[model samples]
Target: MRKYGRTDEASSALAVQLRSYPANERTHYKHAVHQHFSHRNEPLTKEDITQALCQLNGQKGGNKS
Candidate 1:
């Protein structure tokens, strides 16, 4: 709740994605995600994901207040 903002879905997409990983790879992927989000001071909101995707595609997201 703190790291990622409220999701509209009934279940977490992140959990579903993680579960798709092979059993041997789950631990490694989980640890990597934790390490990445743990350092972020602000919660990861939908807007954050959108911005990330935009940046990934080499486009800049509009500024937010």
Candidate 2:
């Protein structure tokens, strides 16, 4: 079964999305997540959401082979 914690859910979805894209695109996504989460107390923009998704994808991949 998939372990679905609040943080896990976000990263899991990001990983699936990353599998659909090329390597270079993943970097942009990672940067966005880092920027947004780093300043999470502030408002998130559309770009921030996009970035978070990217970051999640990369993080998920790192956990696997």
Candidate 3:
């Protein structure tokens, strides 16, 4: 079983996505990607995901602050 930072529905979805990765790469990938994004230094809130998606689609997210 995999461990996640939170147990809410959104966190569950993230866990499911992580689980889809190959077993050999799962832990390291999750630790590196998720931990970096979710760390307090950057603080990945739900808003960050939305902002990222917008940026990916060529739309600019409003000011970071």
Q: Who wins the lDDT comparison?
A: 2
Worst 10-residue lDDT window, candidate 3 = 52-61
Please give the CA lDDT of all the candidate structures: 0.48, 0.56, 0.48
Clashes of 1: 0
* C-alpha root-mean-square deviation, candidate 3: 8.6
Q: After superposition, how far is residue 57 of candidate 2 from its true place, in Å?
A: 15
Ranking by lDDT: 2, 1, 3
lDDT of 1 by residue, 1-65 (tens): 64533354412544555566679866665455544456676555545444443343343225443
**Residues 1-65, candidate 2, lDDT per residue (tens digit)?**
22222254456555566666789777676455555566344444445456667457568676453
The per-residue C-alpha lDDT of model 3 at residue 16 equals 60
Q: Output the better candidate (2/3) by TM-score.
A: 2
Candidate with top TM-score is 1
Residue 14 of candidate 3: its Cα lDDT? 47
Native-referenced Cα lDDT, model 1 = 0.48
Stretches off by above 4 angstroms in model 3 are: 1-7, 41-65
Model 3 lDDT tens row, 1-65: 23434336545554565566569855654455454455444334455444434343343336465
